[model samples]
Target chain A: MNTVDFLNSREDLLSPGISACQGCMAELSLRVILKVLGEKTVLVVPPGCMAGAAVGGWNKSLGTKIPAAMPQLGNSASMLAGIKAAYDLVDPDVHCLAYAGDGGTADIGLQALSAAAERRDNIIYVCNDNEAYMNTGFQKSGTTPHGARTSTTPVGSVGRGKVNFKKDVPMMMAMQNTAYVATLTPAYMNDFVEKVQKAATIKDGLVYLHVLNPCPTGWGTKPENSIAYARAAVQSRYFLLYEYRNYEFTVSAPTKNIREPKDVTEFLQKQKRFAHLDEQDYEEVRRVVNSRWENLKKLAGL
Target chain B: MENEYRVVYGDSGLYVLDTASWRTFRPVIDETKCVNCGTCLLYCPVCAVKKVDGRIQIDLSYCKGCGICRTECPKQAIMWVKEEE
Candidate 1:
């Protein structure tokens, strides 16, 4: 694709009358995704940040002419399955997509999500994970990593923040062996869109993608550094990006060594959520990040 | 809660995904030009695109707001349509 071609389509995907923050990664994600999906697509959103962003009382966030529907807080997967089934009944050529957040995916709606994937539901599941539940407040969720403070995980001598590590969701989704499973970032738009396109073509099975969206208000970072912090997290190996299709792993980012790992200070210091972390705790956090990166590299056979 | 608004230079109410935005950096696919060849599908990094009933489709949740398919399509089927007016 030429630069002009890329430049031309951006105008139609994401319109301006939405409530997303200035540098909201989720907003950017919706635009890129809808542009390719086109107007003939159907979107199903659950009660998460996506729902709050996309469908408001007055202004529907999506810019595309594609029709969208909203399900309950934890029923997007089932809703997509129903929508696909109904569309099939009519024999119409349309795509059904379900978008949710980590809370909806890994916690409240886990059962429905697994059932849909196991049944080979003909839909795309996109989890716009900002690591915490930012819509109602910065409450922590399953995707929140250890040591990252949140509204649910306050900082004190008891601990820095979340007590548990982030869940290995992609691996779990890959376990379904449905068809396509990927973990991507807004930083890599080509890879991200390409994957979305591929998911659209796959046969009767579930296509699952977990996107790491950095939050300015929740993460206590500046709006300008939202993308920068996200890219750094991936490049630094703190949050690895990769794709797994039919059990084969392809690591998206390649880093030399995570030692010292670009100083977690930049990432940690920016967000008030992590303001409690001291220098001594930095070593533990670094160790965790390195270990996760090494494990992912091994999985990718890199 | 409330819809957010940004003043735009154009008369049309459309505000397309500005490719220049730092938060996003990819091309958008114009459905009018897409031919459902599925070539862009095979190479996509996230598998965001798919074919439902022989028609190419896109999944936004995993899309990362990238524009790879917009450039890769041979038919020039996918063009970037900006926001209304």
Candidate 2:
């Protein structure tokens, strides 16, 4: 199908009237993912934003006709693995998807995810990293960037937000030798859909997608700036877009060039979470972002 | 006949939900101003705007009134109107 036709042909997998906050990128990402995966897919969501978007309560469900299973916050990966194994026995053609938040993927559910990756489970695991525990009131998560204030990492007289850098979950998953591992954002819809399609074709092992879901509520940004922040993140090199498969690493087309990269501070300045960042903090963040950009360029053989 | 207390699966199949109640501002398209460029159909996060019968149609049931359609419309076709209580 042509680009427009392909996109338009997608059945709306997410039912409307669900309680997702305005300009919630997580909800948008799920909409795109469901459009790509279709009705044959089974989603295994944990206690995260996606879960709330999918099935709000016992009486209300705005999710698609595709079957969904809600596991505990830490058991999403294992639960998906078991479900995938059952699908393998019954119908190997079925797709099993695990959707979890950054806290669930990078922190609490890391062990389960690691176990699934080690076993080469045939499933697609999507980590909707909004950078904080947004559903539970914007607490600091493992993927929260340094110097970003959160409920748990408030900017106090003696403390300056989170001290550590965001955990490299994509790289960690790539190290596990998964069939496919990629990082994407809703700003680039075509690329995101292409990557999801590619992940579905890989049957040898797990497919991990670390999507940067910008949370307007948690990031303290205007609702309309959700896609703008995501684009700024890529332009600033804070979130590099790339995919790893068969030991081949390649940067996606949109983020491959850097004639004159935008300043990382431009991306951070818009969000109130970084309001407390001083000049020194900005410099430190720039240094770290530059270092990662260099490493990514080397890996991409740019 | 007995009242069934069991939960029904897939209550609405492709039927639009009435999300107008959730919106403080509702989008109204000016067909005269609209060029039928389909730009709003591409940017809507909820897939609320679509092409029907070769014309642009906004499904208000699922529209959260994010005003993305209004913001992205190239011809200034869509206008956001304050919802009356």
TM-score of each predicted structure versus truth: 0.73, 0.92
Model 1 CA deviation exceeding 4 Å by range: A2-4, A54-64, A157-159, A253-263, B1-85
The second chain of candidate 1 has a TM-score of: 0.55
Q: lDDT per residue, candidate 1, A4-84, as tens digits?
A: 234233344344435565556776676667666766678777877766754312242343345566688788899889989
The TM-score that candidate 2 achieves is 0.92
Model 2 chain B: worst 10 consecutive residues (lDDT sum): B7-16
Residue-wise C-alpha lDDT for candidate 2, range A1-302, written one tens digit per residue: 54445667788766665667777888878877888888788887899887766442334443556677689999899999999988898889899988899999999999999998889998999999999999989999999999999999989888899999989999888877878899999877778888999988999998999999889889999776787788899999999999998887899977886568899888999799999998999999999999988988887788
- Cα error, residue A295 of model 2, in Å, equals 0.7
Docking class of 1: incorrect
The TM-scores, chain A only, for the candidates as listed are 0.90, 0.97
What's the C-alpha lDDT at position A166 in model 2? 88
> A258, model 2: CA deviation in Å?
4.5
For each candidate, report its DockQ versus the true two-chain complex.
Answer: 0.06, 0.37
**Model 2: TM-score for chain B:** 0.75
For residues B44-85, what per-residue lDDT tens digits would candidate 2 score against the true structure?
777787777768888887678777667667798988889887
